[model samples]
Structure formats: structure tokens, C-alpha cells
Target: MLNDRYDNPLTTRSQSARDAYVEGVDSILSANGDGIGLLQGAVQADDSFALAHAALARALQISARGAEAVAAITKARALAAGISGRERGHINMLGHLIDGDGALAYAAALDHLAAFPRDALIAQPLTGVFGLIGFSGLSGREAEQLAFLAQLAPHYGEDWWFGTQFAFAQIEVGQADRALQTIECALERNPCSAHGAHVRAHIHYERGETEAGLAYLGEWRRDYQRRGVLYCHISWHVALWMLERGDAAAAWRIIDDCVRPGKVWGPPLNVLTDTASFLHRAELMGGAPQPERWREVSEFARQLFPKPGIAFADVHAALAHAMSGETDALAKLIAEPVGPAGEVVAALAQVFAAFARQDWTESIALLAPVMATHERIGGSRAQRDLLEFSLVAALLKAGRPDDARLTLISRRPKKVGARAVAGL
Candidate 1:
């Protein structure tokens, strides 16, 4: 038996397998390339390595390779019988998450963390504002995320990766100064870390420090490898700040160069959401890109048309269909019932559809009641602001200038250059 970097026991009997698994985990925490090849390579070196199988499954799930994820995890579970309890916990946690059972995943992760506090893999699902618990209907999610990290802080003393994770959690829960301090420590430790850059971008986004965010990301992102997982997302953040500063051209350039048809960062769903959401808002700013661009996005989105599982993806899918004038497809999507969060998704779908048709009154009506619950869609506040932007745009277009003003003021601390993006 061997232990991972976190001192969690592994069932692997091969030293080569252990080395590959450790490298894969490190790559994952660094938000670098998929690391799937390394994880799979570990299992190839030792087919009975349950942890490697589980890790590969988790990576597959993240990339939206659902069939492969299921097969991999099934193999992991079959081989996990003789593993240590903590290693078994990894298989269980990945199982729950891949099945979309977020609550069960969070519980398994928490239980695993209690016994292996430094297991970054297990800690990951419990630490972020958008982690398993964050998506599990937990209240005070950001606070809860911070509290969980606080407990594990001692276990990860001076770990640069942990520092970046901690900083982002702080930023999410309104501890801007602390986030800055923590992120500075992380960057000092590893300036090329995509995790550090991602957190630093979020910190700047929170404080409305648009210029600083742009400068920081511009300098750092130039050296960022295209293979990094955060490549598209970090570029998305850059586009956001550029939009804030009324530089739509620069923002679109980021979208075209980094996030679109060229690269593979993570899941297609993530890229689709960022591209479609950005374009939806860009159009509102009177800077509509080429119609062919919307058609390209719409075509990609159409492949997952009727089975939009996640609310966040569903809304963006709606944006794609609506913008492409695929009214029939959009109608069908609205009619289909998703799960508990379906109402919010359906309402948002209608909101975008209405906005596309210039039916401002309909857009306002559909978006207003569901506005408060937008967080349930499972994205960062910056991402969820797309909904608010849509509503405000509707309010103004509908001749309700006063309501639009109120909505704008309500978004406290304000979004960098969002007013310019919305033409407010």
C-alpha cells in the first residue's frame, strides 16, 4: 500500500502508478490540463488502482464524457472492495457527484475530509462557493465554504494551491482585503498558477477594480498555456472586465481567441454558457456580433437541446436558440420540465426569448419573480448577473426607466463597466 501526498492510503501496489496518480492530482489542483491522461495512465500501470480509476472518472465527468465516467467509476467501485476507507470514500464521492447527487457527494466529501483533512481531492468539493455543498441547496454557502476551509487551514500550512482556494472563498464571502492578501501569497509562491490567476481575477471583479483586473490577467494570461482548464474561464473573466471598461471589441477578441471553437478547456457546456451569455449581453449593448456567430453557437447548443440538465446551461441554451431565431426549438425547451430548478430555468428561457423578440413587457414579467432565486442556477455572482442585466434591459426597453434605475442601484458595489455593457 502507498499513501498519496495527503497521507491517504492507496490500494496501488505499483510505484509508477502512485507517481502518476500524485501528478494527476497536482495537475487538477493547479487547474492545468485535463490530467485525464495521467490518471488513466496510472490505472494502466496498475489496473487495480481504485483511486486512479475514481480520479479518472471524476475528470471524465468534468469534461462531460458521461458514458466514460460511468464506466470508469463502475470499474473503480468493483476494485475498491479491499481499499482503505479513505480511498473507498473517493470512489463514493465521485459516484455521487457524477450521478448529479450533490447532497450525497457533499456528505461523502465531508466525511472523507474528517478522516483525511489534507486530502485536497476531497477538500476541493467542500471548499469552493460552487462546490458540492454550494450546488446542494446549502444556505450561507459562501460562509459555509469559508468555515470548512478554516478547519483545514492548519493541515495545509503554506500550500500555494490551498492559498489560492482560500483566497477565492474569502472573495466570495466578502472578505476582499483578506482575499487580496492570501492571493498575493499564492502568486508569490507560484506566479504561473492558473488557480492563483483565477482567484486574483475574482478578487478584482468583487471590488470593481476593472483596470487592475485587466492588467493582472493580461500580463499573466499571456503565458498561460492553452491546455489549462481555466484557460477559457480566465479569458471569460478578462472579457468581463473589458466589457466593464466599454471595450467590447477587446472583449470579443478574447471570446474569439481563447474561449470559442478553437480550444478545449473543460466541458463544452461551460464554453457554451460563457460564449452564449456574453453574446446575449453584448447584443444588449448594441454590439451584436455577426449573425453567423450566433448560428454557430446555436448549432452547438442544439446538440443538447431537449435534455438541458443544469439550470445554468439551460438558460444559456435558451439564449442560443432564441438568438438564432429557433423559436420552435426554444418553445419545445420551455415546455419540457426539468427538475426542481426547472421553473427558474423555464422563466429565464422565456425572458431571453421575449427579449429577443423585443417584447420587453413579457421579458420583465417573466424575469421579475424569479430574480431573487437566480442563485439556484449554480454559478458565480458575476455569471448570474446575466439574469439581472436581462431584467434591467427589459425594464428600460419597456419604458419603465424608474424600475431600471432601481435595479441598477440595487446591484451594490456595482459590476465593473456593466453599466456601459447594458448601455445604462
Candidate 2:
């Protein structure tokens, strides 16, 4: 009865199994290399290790390998009967999540966290922007995320994995100054911390440190393997900064190389959302609409996200559909939005369609009403900036430069310089 790195008791007695499981958990928590493979090794070392199968299931689910994830979780559930209480709870939580029962999964995660606050794997799904809580479609989720991390802070003192996540929570809650300090110290402790690097990049974006962000991420991206969980999204950040710096070719190159539909080796969720967000953001900055690229992403959305439950991905899928002239698909998304933020998703779907048609007034009319509740769509402020800039673009296109100016000043005064609309 050895323990995990977090001191959670393991049911398996194999040292090799325990070691690989720990490494795999570290990989997942840090957004680094080969967690699934490591967990597979752990399972191979001890097939009875219920947590290894559960970890593999969760990793596969996060990587968008749905069928494999289901298989793994099923195995984990079959083995859960003999494991510790903490292990059984962990397996069940991930099972609910992988099976698309998010409400149950979320409730189970909170309950598990209350009993085992140091179970970073259980808490991982509730931490980041795309986590259960972050994408819960609940308003004030950002504040909730911060509070969730804050309460667990004392349990994970000086742990780089927890620090990176906690600092990101701070950044999302508009505490960038403090997040900067936290992430900097975290990164200093683990220089190649992918989660830390991503959080640091967000702080840079928050403070409008365009050139510095581009340079730092440019260097950081070189060593970060493509297999890393955060690779595509992190590359999205680099491309975005390059686009903002007027290095359009470099930006497009990154999109083509690492962030596009056919090219990206990351999660399908990341592929759909990042490509659609970057392409439209690039278009607002006067970049020509690449119909072929739009078609690729729209097709990607069609095949992968046939029915969108995640509100953030749904809106981007709608954008890709609208931009690619997949009117039937776009119309379907607008008519049948899903999840807690379905109302906001529906409106934004129409907004994207209107914007695609150059119906600026319609876009604005549809978009403005959802502005107050857009947080329910679930993404970090940096990722959701696509919507903010879209409104600015719509206002400019509708011969409402003054309104656009006021909107920028009133809502995102600090990001005015980063708004991409030509007239603005």
C-alpha cells in the first residue's frame, strides 16, 4: 500500500505502478508530455490498479479520444470495487465527466475535493478555463474558480502544479497583478512548466504586453512538444500576439503549422475553437477571409462537434459554419443551441451569421443583448476577447465608430489598442 505523490493511498503495492502513475498525474497536472502513455505503463505494471485506468480515462477524455476514454473508464469502474474510498470516488467522478454527465461530475468533484483537497487530479477538472467550473455556463464562474482555488491553496503550498492553476484562477478574476507575481514565481521554480508558461502569457495579454508576450511564448513554444495537452492552445496565444503585433505572416504561419484543423495534433475542442477564433480575429484586422481555411474548420466542426454541448465550442463552430458559407449547418446551430449558456450561444450563432453576411446592424442587434451574459459561454477573458473585438468590428462596419469607441472605452478600456477593427 504505497502512496501517490500527493500522499493519496494506493491500492496497488507495485512500486513501478505507483511511480508511473505519479509521473502520469504530474504530466496531466502540468500539461506536459504523455500522461496517457505513462498511465498505460502504470496499468501494465499493475492491471488491478483502479486509479491508473481512471487516470488514463480522464487523460483520454481530455485529449478528445472519446471511444478509448470510455473503454478505459469502464475498466476503471470494473476495478473500483476493491480500491480505496478515495480511489473509488476518483474513478466515479472521471466516469461521470467522460460520459458527459457534467452536473453529476461537477457535484461529485466538489464532494471529493471536500474530503481530499490534495487530490489534484480530482480538482484538475475544476481548475482551468475549460474545466467543469470554468465552462459550467454559470455566471460569476470566474469568481467561483478563484474562490475554489483559494480555498485549496493552503493544501498545496509551494507546489508548482497547484501554483500555476491558482495563479491562472487569479488572472481570470481580474487580479492580473497578483497573478503575475504568482505565476512568475511558479515558472521560476519550474522553468519549463507548460501551465505556468500559459498562465504567464495570459498575464502578459491582460496587461497588454504584446511584444513581451510574443517573445516569451515564441521561445517557450520551441521546446514544448506537440504532444503536450496545452500545445495547440498555447500556440494559439503565440499566433494571436503575432497578429496583434502586425506580424500577420508569422501569425498565419503559426496557424497553418500548429493551430489549424488538419495540422493540429491537439484536442478537437482546441482545434475547433482556436482556429475559428484566430481566423475571425485576423479577419477583423483586415486580413482577407480564407474561404478554404474556413471550410476546413467548418468541416472539422461538422465532423467533430456535430452537436455542441460546450457553449464556447458551439459558438466557434457556428462562426466556422457561417464564415464557410455552410448556411445549413450555421442555421442548425442557431436553431438548436445546447448547454446552460444555450441562449447566449444561439444569439452569438446568429451574430456570426450576420457578420458573415456583412449585416452589421443585425449582428450588433443580436450580439448586444447577449453581451451582459457572455461569460456564461465559458472561456477565459483572453479567449472570449474574440467576442469583444467582434462587437467592435460590427460597430465600425455599421458606421458607428463613436459607439464602437465608447464600447471599447467602457468595457475593455485597457485593450483598446488591441482591438482589431480597421476603422477603430
Candidate 3:
């Protein structure tokens, strides 16, 4: 029955409906809320459907109901038992979702590939898992997984679904130029591919090409609108770039657009938190404390934490407190070991503390390692670039122009908008 949903010559009507359902599923995955109501109706009509269950599980997961997602996936697995081919690949996707370890999931995906080699659906999740682990620079297993993906690309064709994964791996490995080329190639092959456009935007944004990055977002927005999909994170990326460029007003505009009331498939809190953080930072940069927004952002940050541990939320919380001049609050917040995100927040808090004390040397020393580590891990490139710019400002204040120049030169193509370049 599950196999009939994907491929069955005899059940023409069933096959047509299933094809439309799969398209709806992909649209929902890409952040289309309009399809969810339709999908809900389709699932109700076919209760024994594994594909419907999988799609519902994905939709629920994006909506932030993890427990409900687990239930849906359980039903999917049971119904998928007699399925084969592409339908089995969908089951493997549920496995990837259940397993938190990206490297392990990628390995398991490869084992599934032995039985279904030519399935593009299988390649999509495998690529995402590899990119997740690869971006963290976790050696050995991540490297092997990425290499396997790169090898798989040529066999599948240059325009394969894994192309963006290869580009992201290149970026993580510090080959930004190559990453740009790879994405450009992918876009050339399929101009309408949102995946290619998204990757290209990241490449440009990370390299400090703010105007180019924004243009890519425009392109992506057109493509997304045409397809009735949404890129929720793109607004945050644009806001961060504007903030880094010292355009507080422009940044706030992006934030406003992000949180404007709308029907959305995923949890709207992600963008809400981003808008709050950007507002808090912009207020601080403008030399006024936004007390109300500070509280709002902090509350959202708290809500965002205690889950998969969003690194940005922790750093934003610490920064919000620091901007409000709540030194004690900042100190207490950074004390928790929230993994990579906490480390970043702690480093920033130390800088803010030193700055408050008018101790320039201490501030420079505190920010050095934080900047280095974030640059390596592909942390928000916009944020890292701005931090490097701030480091130069701190160094100049400390009368250390030589060190500032060295730091400026090390970031290369990303040095364009950096305040450090002015010091050079």
C-alpha cells in the first residue's frame, strides 16, 4: 500500500493523488503553510498511509511539537514495513530525525543507500545530515561522510540534490571561493532551484558581500513566492548583515518584516527571537537601552534554550543583558555550560565587562579566542565579521594597530566591510 503511494502502474488515481501529496509535502518542508490544511485533509482520507504520516510528522516537528512528531513517526514506521524503493527512503528520513547525531545518521543513510542507490529523496536527507556534522568541523567521521557525498555527486550528475551539501562542506573546510563556484554552477544548471539560491546567499553573506548577499535574497524571495514557499531564516540573515554594517534602521526594518503577523507552517518563535535580539543590539549601538525589548528578547531566549540548545539564543541573551548594563545578569547567564553557544556568550560577556571597566587590554584578550573559534565553525559569518571589526576598534583604542592589521588581513575577502580595514 505504501509502495502504491510512490509508484504503482495499476492505481492511476491513487498515483496522481499521491504525487500531488508528495509535492505538498515538499512545499511544507520548505515552509509553505498553505499546503498543511490540504495535506491534513488528504491524510484524513487515508488513515493507513505511511507517507501521509511522515509528512504530518515533519509538519508537526517544524511546529515544535516534538512528542506529537514522535507519535506520527511511530505510526509511519509501522505502516512503512511492507514498502520498498523510494518509500523506504522516506522511512530512513524519520530515522535521521529521531537520531540527534548527524554523523551516525549519515552512516545509517549510506547503509540504506546500498539497497536504493538512485533515489534523490534519500540523497536529500543524507546531504542535510552530512552538512550539519560537517559544519561543526568534527573531524574523522564528518570528513569521511562529506567525502562520500562528494563522490556520490558526480555519479548522480552535477545538478544532483547533494550539490548544495558539497558547497556547504567546502565553506566549512575554508574553501569559500570554491563553495561560491559550486553554488554558481548549481544555479546555472537549474536557475529555479531554491536550494542553490540559499547556498549562494550564504556564501556571499559570509564573504562580506552584503549587497550581493541581499540581491541573492531578492532572487530567493522571488523563487520562493513563485513556488508558494518561505525562507524564514533569510530575514534574520539580512537583519544581521544590516546590523553589522551599522545600519540600525535597516536592520530594524528587516526584523519588523520578519515578525509581521502571518500564517506560517513552522514555529514563528524562531523569527520572533531573532527580531528581539536585533532590536536589542540596535538599541545598544544607538547608545540607548531598550528595557522593554531587552526583557522580551531575554524571555524568548530563555524559551529557545533548554531544547536542542540554539547557540545564537544564548549569545543573544548575554548580549541583551550586557547592553542593558545588567552586569550581574550577564555574568550569571554565561556561567552555564550551554556548549558552543555558551562559550561564545561567555567570551562576549568578558569583553563587555572589560569595556565597562575601561580596561582595553583585557577586552582585546577576551575577544581574541572567541573570534577565532567562531570564524572556524562557520558561526554566523555576519556576526563573526562584525566581531572582527570590533576587535580592530578595540585594538586601535589599545594602540595596537599592528595586531589589528594582521587580524584584518587574515579574514581576506571578508575584510571588505570590516572596520579593521580602515585601520590597515
lDDT of 3 by residue, 241-337 (tens): 6665667677666565554224232244444445544554353344355666665555555555534234444555565555556666677756764
Q: Model 1 shows how many backbone clashes?
A: 1
- Error (Å) of candidate 2 at residue 351 is 0.9
Alpha-carbon TM-score of each model against the true structure: 0.89, 0.97, 0.74
lDDT of 2 by residue, 295-339 (tens): 999998889888778898889989988999999988887788678
lDDT of 1 by residue, 1-424 (tens): 6888777778878999999998888777776754789998899999999889888887777666899999999999998778877778778888898887877887888888788788788777665545664554434566777888888899988788899989988887779999999999988987777888888888887788888889999888888777677788888888877877788888988898888754555457668888887787777677755678778888877775457656667778888888888888688668984854677677777887887788988888888888765766667767777887777778887888878878867764456245633546
- lDDT of all predictions: 0.78, 0.89, 0.56
RMSD of each: 2.7, 1.3, 4.9
Those runs of model 1 whose alpha carbons end farther than 4 Å from true positions after fitting are 127-130, 137-140, 262-265, 416-418
